[model samples]
Target: MSMVNQTQVHETRLSDAVNRIAPSGIRRFFDLATSMDNVISLGVGEPDYTTPWNVREASIHSLERGLTAYTANAGLIELRRAISTYLTKRFAIDYNPDNEVVVTVGASEGIDLAIRAIVNPGDEVLIVEPCFVSYAPIVSLTGGVPVPVPTEISNDFMVEPEEIVKRITPKTKAIMLSYPNNPTGAVMSRKKMAEVADLVIEHDLTVISDEIYAELSYDDEHVSVPTFPGMWERTILISGFSKSFAMTGWRIGYLCAPEPYASAMLKIHQYAMMCASTMAQYAALEALENGQEMMDEMITSYRQRRNYFVKSLREAGLSCHTPGGAFYAFPSIKETGLTSEEFAEAFLMEERVAVVPGHVFGVGGEGHVRCSYAASMSQLEEVVERLKRFNAARIGR
Candidate 1:
């Protein structure tokens, strides 16, 4: 009788969408590095700097005042107002704080909300390749096809309009863009961005533009997609304080779009997230108001690091394009005759340095590996020494 139990055995069911995507390749290497001792990691893209003291104090003050309750579904009105003001001041874009902005948990959440709001099942979303790894998987989770439009290092990694045009189809719904782009550190020139903008207008497609690294642009003024003619109506702009303000743990990001789209994203935000943290909102408000000097100092440091690191990589016998923005150095490892994953693993094991395999970033990311320059200069100097040794060994082998 004990052996003839009536309960039927059933395997746990998970969403096919969840099953479809692979675990993040960035986190895999980061975790492997964490498990080791005295490892100088260039794997994760996080800023090594801590959040500014004034911003932290603002959050602490909010807690002292007993402001721990949940905010409105759209987030604190004051924070929204600050965000609207900051955008207008910094990027010359306008959004009505009341109805056009929704504060999200992070720029990461803003991406998720924007995709889920607009992407219908079976729709196709064009993703710029060698991008932040989250984009394609998020599109796939919504049952939308993630079509990668690859950019090349030889072309300075700028997206070519003709390539995008080739990928266009009736099922295509929107295009996802990130300039001061992750992994590649490519920033789209305004002239080039305008060309892409023209295509979006001609096709009547929406643009989900993630400008989280907007303030980190080193070569030229960062362009906001919404600033282009006809783009304001169609672009859902996403940005945050993570990279620029060293506020990654605060998780404060926002979405700005037209009323209809904002409302839709708000609906999803209300149900799924309710609201972003109240304390973080206060902290974000302070950052927008008074964190400019500290942010500028961080940017200056990153620029210096970028110059030294890229030069160092090339001198060490790897072909690295000088990044126009962001803190990553994407160098071709193809000369070693090893895949990106193999190189990253072997580099980590032998040299005690950690860099992410570029193939994880989607098409066109292969034959390269992404090394972050966000670590200390001393660490970077050591990384270059080890890289030189590694390259020499590979060449000799």
Candidate 2:
């Protein structure tokens, strides 16, 4: 009779997939770095540069003109048109502005929308290991199972076509590819891309290609996977100004996909976010139209830093590859006799320098750590000295 007269109670029903998803290891290290004073962070994957002055001016202009209302679910006509021209001019891909593009809150939201639009319960989505953290989680949340294909350091982390072919099953619905990749900074060559395109066509699987760091390609020119034959109908090209233009806070990104897919994605976006920020959209349009000069300058700087950091890693006795694109340097920390997490923690505590543990990226990432060189030259020099000191002690032992 204990509480027998009470009203009925109900238990919460959370999806099993939601409960099973792992948190980003990269973010955990970043949080740890923030709590420690005097720490030099190379953990977060963000550009440290200021937003271009011209982009800022555009936003201010929009505000002064009293353009504050919700424009359209698809986005402002002017911005979409600007994106159309920019993509064609830069990547040689064609998309109709009226039906093929949808502005997003960020490439992050674009990813979520893409997953939601295509995935049904229990469908399979192929992903490359040491990929961006959000891809797998977004797939799970959409009730799509993530099938990870591990890339090798010996191969420079480029996905092998045979590996992709081997991983595909009848349930596979889509594949996600990111080049000028985070963590590894590996880029797919044209021949490699052609192989992937052939596979995606053969498998009849959709593709979500994250090319956010497209403009940061150091060794080779960046190309859109969608530009390859047969990929146009099956690919969603995701990019933004955040990494390229140092406009991370602006939070405006866009996706270009074939229609019906684009329309469905826009529906999800309409309900979930309504639209990207009106002010940010204006700034992003300005970025597309006038930010190329700014990009040339930043890319030149990143290339210089990339060269310096790669040499520093080798001189410090760490095993590393020459990254072709992006601002990160992923190097093996195994020789130091510490697990990735142990190496990260000990380095932070003793040297006051923080880097993301590679295991956070996936099984293939063990024994490695990602160091972002997006910081200033002075900061890079300081971190290099700290790493050298750490390596000297390890060698002495």
Candidate 3:
């Protein structure tokens, strides 16, 4: 075949949805950092701590006992019940584990199930930005329109209800929220969240709330969306042991919703992924039961790192808002007169310091770079020194 004809055939073989979305901006830098020597990465988002020993031992015990068979499609009842109890105690919300929770491969898959269950083709999903890189692409893959409602750093990246109101339309089916958000590490105030809840109730829309970082809230106790009045029926809560328990590789996450939504998502979960790993589920159960002290220690360390990192970024001449949750510091690179991508690439190549370009995170992200403080304190200290040198060179030029 002619080269032109071969190219056309290759293009035609892929789905339109696959072609429409871009690859993850985070992964591109991650791959680059991995290939290079001595790169100090502030790019990836997982916790620096290993899964606690007790949690690992629980999984080892499960495997030793040959408890390797799949649990129910909804996951081990004990884990679900534990999740239910934890939610009640932590967020003052109640969920019936029997019919309302479905464990998935990760919070990533829980997000996929929620969007797939609720969004019909051509329906609009309001996504607050800058968010985790996956949300918009996942919505698009489902043939749903992802409407970006950009939140400003000036507001600490909190999504104002008016921004959401401006984007709503007759076809809007849902809104996606992640507080203690990714990239920016912005957490919403309860008063602000209540305002958003009011909007959701007014519009009669469903909410896909990703609360994976709920336990890592630094300044105040994290608030679950479903805890708000009138929100229980409308919110799908997604969380897991990945961040808090340092079990990213274990792939145990879950979603909770009203029976109708829960059942619909469970049906999808059954067909797409029968169940999360049995051993992982066992480990997660151990985490809920006995991992609190270790998790609390990790949170304390993260809080200290966050304070030091943000302070260093400011002193290095970058304007950074104090992130209320998560471990990222999104600092403006606007003063350097470089786009986020340019700054990130140059910083990586010259200083061996890796950060994600903010524009990849969607609207209102172009002038900043996302730096994760989830690394060791020593690495973070060195990163600040490299950043200072980089900034000085830029000024000199």
> What digit string (tens of lDDT, one per residue) describes model 2 on residues 237-257?
899889998999999999999
Among the numbered candidates, top TM-score falls to 3
Question: Tens digits of per-residue lDDT for model 1 on 1-397?
Answer: 3433422221125677876799999999999999999899999888999998999999999999999999999999998999999999989999999999999999999999999999999999999999999999999999999999999999989999999999999999999999989999999989999999999999999999999999999889998899999999999999998999999988999999999999999999999999999999999999999999998998899999999999998888889899988899999999898999999999999999999999999999999999999999999999998998888978652
Which ranges of candidate 3 are over 4 A from the true structure? 1-8
lDDT (0 to 1) per candidate: 0.94, 0.90, 0.94
Clashing pairs in 1: none
The residue ranges of model 2 lying beyond 4 angstroms of the native Cα positions read 1-13
Question: What does candidate 2 score in Cα RMSD to the true structure?
Answer: 3.4
Where is the poorest 10-residue window by lDDT in model 1? Answer: 3-12
Model 3, 342: alpha-carbon shift in Å? 0.4
TM-score for all models, in order of appearance: 0.97, 0.95, 0.98
Cα displacement (Å) at residue 324, model 2? 0.9
lDDT of 3 by residue, 194-267 (tens): 99999999999999999999999999999789989999999999999899999999988999999999999999
* lDDT score for candidate 1 against the true structure: 0.94
Clashing pairs in 2: none
